[model samples]
Target: MIQRFLAPHRTVAAGMLGRLARRAAVCALAFGIAGAHAQETSSIVIKGKDGWLFPGWGSLTQVDVRGIDNTTRLIGQARDLLAARGIKLEVLLLPDKTLFYEDRLPDGQTLSPEVKARYGLILCKLGQAGISTFDDAAVLRQLKASGQEVFYRTDQHWTQASADATAEAMARMIGRDVAKLDGRPGTGMTLGPLFNERRYGDLAELFLTADEKKQVGREVYSVRRQAESSNLVDDAPAPVHVTGHSMVQPYFGFPQKLSSLIGRPVSVNWNPGNVGPWIVLLEYVESPAFRQQRPQVLVWQMFEPTFAQGPDASGLWDNASIMSANAWLDRLKTALSH
Candidate 1:
C-alpha cells in the first residue's frame, strides 16, 4: 500500500534530487575558481594596525631568521674575497620598515620578541667578520626621533636625510673627514636643493588596488637641482664605488648626497628596484668600468630581508648567472685576481 502511494511521486522526487546534486557541483566549482583568484590577490597589500598599508612580503610575519647563520658566512667570505684584492667591502643593510613601525602593524599581528634585535644581530656578525658597516638602523631611529622622516610613509626607500646621515657615518668609518674631503671651497658643490617636487610613491602604485590607490594617497618630495646649479662638475672615476639597487641610484640622491658628504665623486651602478643585490654586485664587478678603474672601497648596499634569500628569490637573475653563496665567493675570488 505504501509503495503504491509513493510510486506516483517517485519520478518527481528523483528529478529534484538530481537537480540538487548538479547545483551543488556548480557551486563548488564556482567557489574553487574564486578561491584561486583570492589567493592570487591576497598578497597585494596588508592592512596595518594604524590604517597604514604594507607590502605582504615585507611584513614581519613573513620573516625567517633561521638563515642568519648562512647569511653571516656569506658576508664573512665575501669580505675575505674582496680583501685579498686590497678592496675593502663595506656592507650596508637597510632595515625593513615593519621593524621600526611595529606599532602600526595589524591588530592581530605580533612580532617575535627577538625581531626587534635582528638589526643588531646582523651588525654584530658583520663586525665579528671584520667587515665595515654603519649602524644604519640606529642612525635612522635617531633621525626619526629628532623629527626627520628617515623613510617615506608610503614608500620603502630612505629619505634624503637618512641618506645624508648614512653618508656621513660611512665617511667616518672609512676615516675620510668630509670637511677635509671637500677641500675645494669654490667648486660650488652644495646640498641645498633648488626645489621640491611632489610625486606618487612606488608603493602607492604597486601594492594598492585601483580603488585603494585613489582613496589612500601618499606622495614623495623629490629635491631637484636648478638650471643655474654649478655645484656639480664632471670628474674622473671616483676612488669609492657604490653598487646596489634603486636605493643608490642617481635619481634617489643617495650617490650624490653621499658624494657631497664624503667630499669626493663616487661611481654608482644600479638597476631597477627588486633586481636583488647579488646580480647587481656581480654585474658591477664584471663590468669594463670596474676593470678600468678599480676602487679602493666598494660600498655594497642591500636590504636586510633579502640578505639571506638565495638567488632564486630574486627571480630577476638567470640560473646560470647566479650561484649559491659559496660558489659566488669562489667566483668573486677569481674575478678580483685580475
Candidate 2:
C-alpha cells in the first residue's frame, strides 16, 4: 500500500488522460448530431400547406426580384447572334406561386399583390417581344385552381408527375399529339426495391435530418428501372428532339421509357442552373448535323423564371460558343417549315 501511494504522479497523469479522452469523444458525438440535424431540415425555408412541395425562390414571378433591362432588344441581338452560328432559341418562363399568394404568406413578409402584378407585366412584355414563350402562367393558374400539385415537396424541381405534364405541354407546343408516358413499369417482380423508395431529391436529406428524419415523409420514386424488356407505355414512339435546361435532361431516359417516346440519338446538349434552355434549342436548330437527322418532334424544355428577365452576363446569350438567339430562331422557323 505504501509503494502504491508513493507513485503520486501516476494518479494525476492518468486522471488527466481520462478527462481528455472523454472530451474528445463528446466533441465527435456533437458533430455527428449536428450533421444529422441539418439533413433532416430544409435548407431553404418554404411555407407549404398540407404536404405539397414546390420550386421556391427560383421561379419567374418573385416579388422584388432582380431582372435585366432592355430585355427585348437584348434577346433580339442574342437571337441573331445564335442563328448566324446555326442555333434555335425558344423561351419559356415558370412563374412563382408565392408572388401570386402574397396575402396568404406568413406574417411579417413584404411580398404583396402589387408585386405579383408587376412580375406578370414583365412576363407580358417579354412575350409581346417575339420570344415564342409558352403560356405557362395561365396553365399554372389553372393547375393551382384545380388543386393539382406541380412542384416537389422537398426540392426546387417539379415532381416527375409534373414533368409528365410538362412533357405533354412540350409535345403540344411542337404541334404533335402524344399520349402521356407512364413512368412506372409493368409487372411487380420486374422492378427493384429502389423504385419503392421514390425519394430522389432534397427529401432524401430530410430523411436523415436530426429533427425531421424521424418523421420525414417517405414517398417512392415515380420512375423506376424496369426489366431489360418491360413495356412502360401503351403505344409506338416517334423520334423527338428536346432542347432546354436540366429540366429536360430526364427526357433522355424518360422518353425511352414511354412506348411512344424515343430519343433522337442525334446527341442534343444540356445545361442546368436556372437557365440554359434556349442554348441547346438554338444548337439543334442551327446545326446542319441536327437538321439532317430530322427528329420528327422538337420538344423545348424550359423553366419560366429565366425567361422573365432575358439574358444576364451568365445567361446563354452571353456564352458565344453555346447559345445564339437570332440565327437560331430563323433556323427554327426553317426547321418548322421544312
Any idea what lDDT model 1 has?
Answer: 0.60
Q: Which candidate has the top score in TM-score? A: 1
Model 2 whole-model lDDT (C-alpha atoms):
0.41
lDDT tens string, model 2, 1-338? Answer: 01110000111146643553344334334323111110112124444443333344342223222232234445544444444543444444555545445444444554433334444544544454444456666665666677865554554455455555544454455433333322232211222222434454453363345555334364544544434544344232224445555554442232322222222121234555433544455555556545455444344444443443333324323464333344444555665444
lDDT of each: 0.60, 0.41
- Runs in model 1 lying further than 4 Å from the true structure: 1-44, 49-51, 59-66, 176-189, 192-194, 226-233, 312-322
lDDT at 33, model 2: 19
- lDDT at 251 for candidate 1? 57
Indicate the residue-level lDDT of 293 in model 2. 51
TM-score per candidate: 0.77, 0.52
